[model samples]
Target: MTIPAPLNGVVPPVCTPLTPDSEVDTASLVALVDHLLEAGVDGLFVLGSTSEVAFLPDAHRRLVVETVTRHVAGQVPVLAGVIDTATLRVVRHAETALAAGADALVATAPFYTRTHPAEIAEHFRLIARRTGAPLFAYDLPVSVHSKLGAELVLELAAEGVLAGLKDSSGDEGGFRSVVLGARSRADVDGFSVLTGSELTVDSALAMGAAGVVPGLGNVDPAGYVRLHRLCVAGEWALARAEQERLCGLFGMVGVGDPARMGRSSSALGAFKAALYLRGVIACPLTAAPQLPLSASEVAAVGKYLAAAGLL
Candidate 1:
């Protein structure tokens, strides 16, 4: 399927289920896709931050795209994240994902090395020139350690180098700038501005963002989809109510003890545990080297699930 130029609605950053032995759990992964589909999400995002993309070995990342794209079969767009440290590596993953049937590729700014805005722009330019696939810039400064400036994004969008943006920078003003730029510029038509913030979907949509890429959507996709619809319909009051409820549900991410694990472990563990408790998957195990939630923490996840009426 041709991905919508300005793709809209909820697109969950899918979680990768792992076997205790640390292999990708294909069955659970596919089942998770079904869960999101049934909830009526507009698209599927695999190998993203929520999917443990940074931790996945190259082979497993390929497997994730192949499995999801093949299973989705064009029901909706399948976006594969070509997350890497630089341009050439991202191009390699982008090519592999496209070959595996992905409809578009989402990439982050070149990371780990100190980078300038010119270099970042060149990184994306090179990938766009070489891969020739629809590209979404993932502006996740928290992970990539570099912010994608609105002017730079607009320049690329005007040049046809970027098809869309996934802004997780948590800078509401900056996000609004991109949203406005996309709408105001004739040359930037079909440029999608998506917010990656679950906590601010209502605000983002209110400000003209095309859609959301909520990581928490993996747990309760229907909630996010409902919120999106309310926002799109201009029902601001109702939308805020629903978003607040989901925000409450999002509290589960903090259940793990901080002394024992980093934020990634706590957040991913909470989501996986909720999925397992909801019977969406067989196990809640995360990828190796990440600490698992303790029994108490898992119980905390259960409480959050219960409060959210997901259990």
Candidate 2:
């Protein structure tokens, strides 16, 4: 299916639920997909940072895309993240995901190596040439260590080499520049610019972002959907209130003790725990080498859910 020219609305980066043995739990995954779809989300993005795609093996990643795409059954676009360290590796993942029924692909810049902006541009261009599918640039400097510049993104978008961008770099100024540039440039009319910021979604949308790809949406899809609706309806005051409420609910990401685990472990762990508490998924286990939330941390997530009326 053709990805919407300007893919808009709330598209959550769906988490990959795992069994106690660290295998992809198909049932839990199906339930999680249904949970989001029922919440009125516009799309599903799998194998993203929130999905622990960096930690998943190739086989597991394939299973996730295949499972989600087949189960979604075209209800909404399913975008698979081709997150890898470099060009060739990303190409391989892109091929696999497309074969597995993904409608489009999202990719980050090369990691584990110091790369120039030109090389990053070439990397995306190469993937676009090879995949022949809708490709979105995932700007995640925190993970990739390379911030995609607004000028470069605009150049690529105008060239029709990039269908969209998902900015998670946390640089609001740069994001605003891209949002405005994409809007003013006639050559990039169909370029969809999405923000991956849960905390600043309303502002991003107000600045002309096409959509949001919030990781927090995995835990509270309805809340994010409501926030997006309010923004689209131009209910700025109510949208700010809803966004602030979600920001408060987002504090669950801090429940895990940082001394005991890394940020990914804590944030992703909190999300899964919340899902489990909400009965969306069966288990809260993340992939290996990541610490699971303790009992207290799980209880803390429960409290956040209750406070947000999610429980």
Candidate 3:
């Protein structure tokens, strides 16, 4: 299926369910896909931060893209993350994702090595030139350590070097600047501006964002879908109510003890725990190096689910 130019609506960063040995849980993945499709998500984003892309080996990453793209079968567009530390490596991942049938690719600015702004721009330009596939810049300063400025994003969009942007930088002002800039420029038509902030979907959409790529959408796709609809319908009051409910559920990301695990471990564990309790996946185990949640932490996730009426 062809991806919508300005992709709209709720697009969840699909979680990569893992086996006990940390292999890709294909069966669980397919089930998770069904869960999202049943809830009517506008698109699917796999191998993203929520999916624990950083820890997965190349083979595992390919398996994820293959499993999801094959299972989804084009019912909705599947955007795969081609995140790596540099240009050529990212280009290689992009090729693999494209070969595995991903409809679009999401990548970040080069990381690990400090790159000049010119280098970053050329990084994207090189990937676009090499792959010739629709590319969305993943603006995650927290992880990549390089911020994609609104000016550069607009310049790329205008030049067709980038098709869209997934802003997860948590800078609402910067995000709004990209949104407004994209809309104001006639040459930047069909350039999607998606917010990755689970807490600010309503505000982002209100400010003319194209859609959302919420990680929490994995646990509550229907909630985000409903919130998106309400916002689109101009029902701000109702949207806020729904957003608040989801916001409450978002608290589950903190179930793991900070003293025991890092934020990634806690948040990913919480998501997988929620999925397991919901019976969407067989196991709640995250990838290696990321600590698994304790029974008590899993129980805490259950509490959040119950509070959100999800369980």
Candidate 4:
């Protein structure tokens, strides 16, 4: 499935706002969508890692998708995240996103099972076939150990079972392999690659990627969108400057600790905190457990944002 042009550029897997009671604050969530769009993001990736898809129930996920889609009204693509550990649940959620008028599916492989490539290829092949929509493989091995092997990824693309892969696998070699392999098939149409690592944005673009899917975009949409535009316009030096500035921000927002309390509990919540400081979201709470930043971290992060001119 080809991406609608409006869907490119810095899209954030936007954070979900919650009520004081910690339910899916529907009104705040809707307002958050408006905020992200107003922030000049190209699209919304609801129910993604930043949205804490793992803890979100199917009903809440669908509601989130429906609300974001209705909120956007097709003005921009809404790539709903489907991180089901089970392929059937993946299928279920993928179909739900399509039914909700979403434009694509950002899927991860069987994380719980740590499935092999052949298994992953089959899983995504079936998921893509079932949904009849474009699939962007979310290949980050941080949450789970084995990942979608690049060879199998290209093989799936060759077989027409997938559209693109978001290479958060975090191995520069793997990212290089994905780009080199896909660009080799330039003779074919509709094959693309999106980088998931914010640190690798410049490198990925130079290595022949379609674009990036960095979490940094969650906070600095304008900055990274300018970086992307600069890269597109052949201004690599200027682009790298923005990339580095945004890269500095990622260190804080990308942190995850097994031991933490308060609102900024996880990387996802930290990202929402950045968005909160930037006024992109109405609140900085996740749907479950909730990620709250430490008081000191709040001040520290605020200082950095001011220094970056993001605040």
For the record, the alpha-carbon RMSD of candidate 3 to the native fold, in angstroms, is 0.6
Local error of candidate 3 at 123, Å? 0.3
Query: Model 4, poorest ten-residue lDDT window?
Result: 1-10
Q: Per-candidate TM vs. native?
A: 0.99, 0.99, 0.99, 0.90
Residue 108 of model 1 has an lDDT of: 92
Order of quality (lDDT) = 3, 2, 1, 4
**lDDT digits (tens) for residues 1-311 of candidate 3:** 78898898899999999988888999999999999999999999999999999999999999999999999999999999999999999999999999999999999999999999999999999999999999999999998999999999999999999999999999889999999999898889999999999998999999999999999999999999999999999999999999999999999999889998999999999999999999999999998899999999999999999999999
lDDT of 1 by residue, 1-311 (tens): 89898899999999999988888999999999999999999999999999999899999999999999989999999999999999989999999999999999999999999899999999999999998889999999998899999999999999999999999898999999999999998888899999999998998898899999999999999999999999988899999999999999999999989898999999999999999999898889988778999999999999998998898
Q: What global local distance difference test value does model 1 have?
A: 0.94
Candidate 4, 167-203: lDDT as tens digits:
7777888878877887676533566677777776877
Candidate 4 clashes: the total is: 8
List lDDT for all candidates, in order.
0.94, 0.94, 0.95, 0.74
List, in order, the clash count of every candidate structure.
0, 0, 0, 8
Clashing pairs in 2: none
Can you tell me which runs of candidate 3 are displaced by over 4 Å? none
Give model 4's TM-score versus the native structure.
Answer: 0.90
